[model samples]
Target: MPHAVKTFRPALGAGSVLLLVVAYLVVALNARFWGVVFDTTGLAGLHGAKVVAAVAAALFALTLLMLLPLSLRWTFRPGLAVVLLLSAAAAFFIGDYGAVIDRHALASVYATDAREAGEWLSLRMLAFIAAFGALPAALLWWVRIDWRSAPRELWSRLKLSALAFALLAVAAGVAGKDVASLLRNRMELRHIANPFALLAANLSYLDHARDADRPFVRIGTDARRGDVLVPSKRPVVLVLAIGESLRAASLDLNGYTRDTDVDLHPLPIVNFGRVDSCGTNTATSLPCMFSDLGRAAYDDAEAKHRENLVDVIQRAGYEVLWIDNNTGSKGLAARAKELSAAEGADPSRCNADGCHDEVLVDRLKTLLPTIRRDTVIVVHLLGSHGPAYHARYPAGFAVFQPECRTNELQTCSDAQLRNTYDNSVLYTTHVLAEIVSLLGEPSALVNRMPIEALRCRARRGHAGAGACPEPDVSPTAAVDPGIDAAMLFVSDHGESLGENGLYLHGAPYAIAPDEQTHVPMLLWASDRFAARRRLDLDCVRRGADRPLSHDHFFHSVLALADVRTAARKPALDLFAGCAPSR
Candidate 1:
């Protein structure tokens, strides 16, 4: 018979538990912070020692602010467990992804859907959570606490708090100057500090949530169509393709060494080589770019309450449709007919990582022939969203060799990551090419034109002898282009491909790298659309290299559809600079 094994359970007082958790958080969960500290201040001499002491004191002060107060019998273990898990998650994202847990980043996190969030789950992430979060939480739950008399416990806690404050004061006094200098020079350090950054983000979220029931302000209600001629006799159809996380520096059209835009090379696309994005991440940029308020005046908290460009265009008598292939359109499509790519996406183009951008192309192809009015279709593409870049495109589109196939970005080599990212961009270009072909060649569209378009043709007397031809649903059917269309492609923001130790976007706007803010913008319009809008392609091409930003997006899009309003700023319209001579 096996002898019964003796169980060993450790008992710790409330103060001791607090100390253990504080120590774990400061040491184990603060690797990214310590790494930054060492990088900024080496392990030698007086200045380094002063900085290290200051940072250590600051970390202790901040961590103790929460732990010291809650280190009581009823709240101690559960509180520590929450702190451990939260800090562990914060540490993982900060250390692995070089992500900052700030307001904008938290906003993106809140907006991310379950499918996109699943891309972040990996074996390493799970193991990290287990070792640092779950294991400590388990021990905290199992270990017995030695409770003292209420009066004694309160007195002991006060004494401990007094001691901690005294130590903190001493440390601050000794290294206050160095701390100030460090903080002034490296402000991002605060954002990388675990638990504090997370706490700060949550606090900001709470503050923003207070305005959840604020009154909605409608702008551009007085919007109307301008005196733009309709010489083409076909209704205008504009496709606004909002690209996701594509940097201008990586596009062949912008002089990138790789032929990422090879498929779009033959098209008469005006590539704005130097375009600044409103924000480094989608949550900030998507809404900001769509708002009438430019970058400097844009406030995320107040944006939802105000009407955006889409609403104004819709009010201007254009039928609006929003097709999202990525995440939902951040409430921009609330007033429009929104179609998700997943609803009718081709199974051949989908996988565990979700469907490729080709699904959007397929959706657009089917929607092209159905245009019967002045319409604006917004196509939100999942372009080059990381870290599973390898799954973003089809196998044939992965021309770059040796891709990083996993979502664990740190495990991949620089080349592998770049290859995978470039492949996604290439695939995006292919989708754009398919769209351009669909819009440029009217044969594909006119052959399958709806009966409504035929009726319009009959009304215009375009049908021979006033007898409209029955719609030919054949691919080889020859017919005049039935619609005047245009396409504008602009990435929501850019990405950081391991540049300067930053892997992905979401840096604060103040210190965001060029790679994270410089996005690609392209415009392609059919001959009829250009002529009707009085747009000169050659003139637009001459200013292709001019400096531009998302500030121009609102007015430019309005100009595309000739939507005029008191809110529309003519000075901000890029196409107006190339308007045809009267």
Candidate 2:
């Protein structure tokens, strides 16, 4: 008892410091991430304070639970450590910052006064002061015990738990502190692992521990497919070809000297300087971009079903045609033209020209003849799609000089990847141009149209090529009512391409990252489309300085397609008077 009294004071002293440091980092990391605090903003009154309290409550509880086995210091390891880190950040950002700040951007860019300095300064983003100040201090305060003498019962038991917590800190630092992703996984998978599995005599403890989230890809057996067949007014149309992993600053249409959109150079179009994607992947982007969650209001928990823009347009009495080359139906497309919606949706299959974009043109010829005056066909192009650049274009579309000659971008030189990737852009120009000629020709027979036999295509990440050609889009010839077209061209996401030691899409903390989310968006119109819609293409194309979220898609399509429904409305859509007729 005398020995215990002597050691308690210093032991409590260090424990107090440990608790404070943990609390500081937990709050600071998240607040900085959520963009809730500016460098100048004092953190005392932030919403993140509540998060800190909650985390502290949980930590205290965990510590109490851990007191059971502290002699060898076998304290909380996996669950507790992960929870502490995630809770700290999530509460800090979402609770405190709300949606006003871009925490991910600040986390990656703030320290350096180089590239993002000017733009980030506008929001007065200040995560740096929080991170540099909090992280080191917390990290240095590891739990320690100078046990010179003590009762065997208390010493052995509590020491184990203390050692456990220390080992945990080291493990976390090595793992790079990506706590948010781990929490998302928990939210995503609900089943608790069966502990009884450990009873198996030969079972590996590690395997049993990780048996919680199984069958990573759930097979959806009920896939219903059918072609979309609907009627509409004789609508002039514009089909925007979306590019994946494309940077807005790289587009020639955006005045990029790199000539990414080279083929479109001769057409009349204006490139907007600032545009951001609703989500970061084809899965996240396809649905979010065309939904009402343009600004991160997407709620999978509140989500019973995804009502996409195409659905609104079709209901508005416009013929909506969806052509896909990448991720199929991605929940959004599944809603429309599927057997469920079609009065008599076809077999949900179509063929095309060479392995490239000719598939879309070929599909269009059949559907275009059947479309009435007020029809809107969204021709989703397989433009500049990537990875195997060598296989995309036909024999000689290579205009940029020496070629990369191969695909697997990670294995090739950046220049080689750039060469091969740019060549794909060269083909994209030819394909889109041919698409323009075919769609523009009101006089030519659909069967006799030139794009029937077109060929080749390519995306992003550790798996792709990065180079692209921007379209010029100068003044072009008049557009016709029989086949009018407007275009909204954008990329689904951007890629790192081996930059800063990152080279893939779906990077963790991937709620929606700029590199993964920053995409090119161009709004171009044929003469007939501009005049008929009675729109100031310039103002609409300018897309307000106000940040646009992907959720506005439901409203945008409803407004542009002239479709009004109880589910969505004119006042709510993200856009007004978009292209491709819908």
Compared with the true structure, all predictions reach lDDT values of 0.82, 0.44
TM-scores for every candidate against the unseen true structure: 0.90, 0.51
Best by TM-score: 1
Residue-level error in angstroms, candidate 1, position 198 = 0.5
* Candidate 2 lDDT trough over 10 residues, lowest sum: 189-198
lDDT of 1 at 237: 89
lDDT of 2 by residue, 466-501 (tens): 543432234445444375566665666665444443
Each prediction's RMSD over C-alphas, in Å, is 9.1, 15.7
Which segments of model 2 are wrong by more than 4 Å? 1-166, 169-240, 300-304, 338-354, 441-481, 508-514, 541-554, 565-582
| lDDT (C-alpha) at residue 83 in model 1 | 85
